[model samples]
Target: MGALKTSKRSDLKNCLTKCKLFRTDVTGSRLYNQRA
Candidate 1:
């Protein structure tokens, strides 16, 4: 049970990181487009 909980927490953290990275990429592309 403890292991499962830890795994879930790690998965949630990974998902959050992925979302942040995706947002950054989208904003970066927008900035690049504006510059071009």
Candidate 2:
């Protein structure tokens, strides 16, 4: 049970990080497009 909770927490963290990265990438692309 404890192991499953730990795994879930890790997965959540990974998902959050991925979402943040994607947002940053999208923002960067938008900025570059505006500049162009």
Candidate 3:
């Protein structure tokens, strides 16, 4: 039961990190293309 909780927490953290990275990548690309 304890291990399961830890795994779940890790998964949640990973998901959040991926979401943040994707947002940053999208915004960065938009800004880059606008300059051209």
What value of lDDT does candidate 2 attain over all alpha carbons? 1.00
lDDT (C-alpha) at residue 23 in model 1: 100
Q: Write the per-residue lDDT of candidate 2 for residues 1-36, one digit (tens) a residue.
A: 999999999999999999999999999999999999
Model 2 ranges with Cα > 4 A deviation = none
* Candidate 1 lDDT score relative to the true structure: 1.00
Model 1 C-alpha lDDT per residue in residues 1-36, reported as the tens digit of each score: 999999999999999999999999999999999999
**Poorest 10 consecutive residues by lDDT, candidate 2:** 1-10
Candidate no. 2 TM-score: 0.98
Q: Estimate each model's TM-score.
A: 0.97, 0.98, 0.93
Off by over 4 Å in 3: none
Cα lDDT for residue 8, model 3?
100
Sorted by TM-score (best first), the order is 2, 1, 3
Best-fitting candidate, scored by TM-score: 2
lDDT tens digits, residue span 1-36, model 3: 999999999999999999999999999999999998
Model 3 whole-model lDDT (C-alpha atoms): 0.99
Candidate 2 shows a clash count of 0
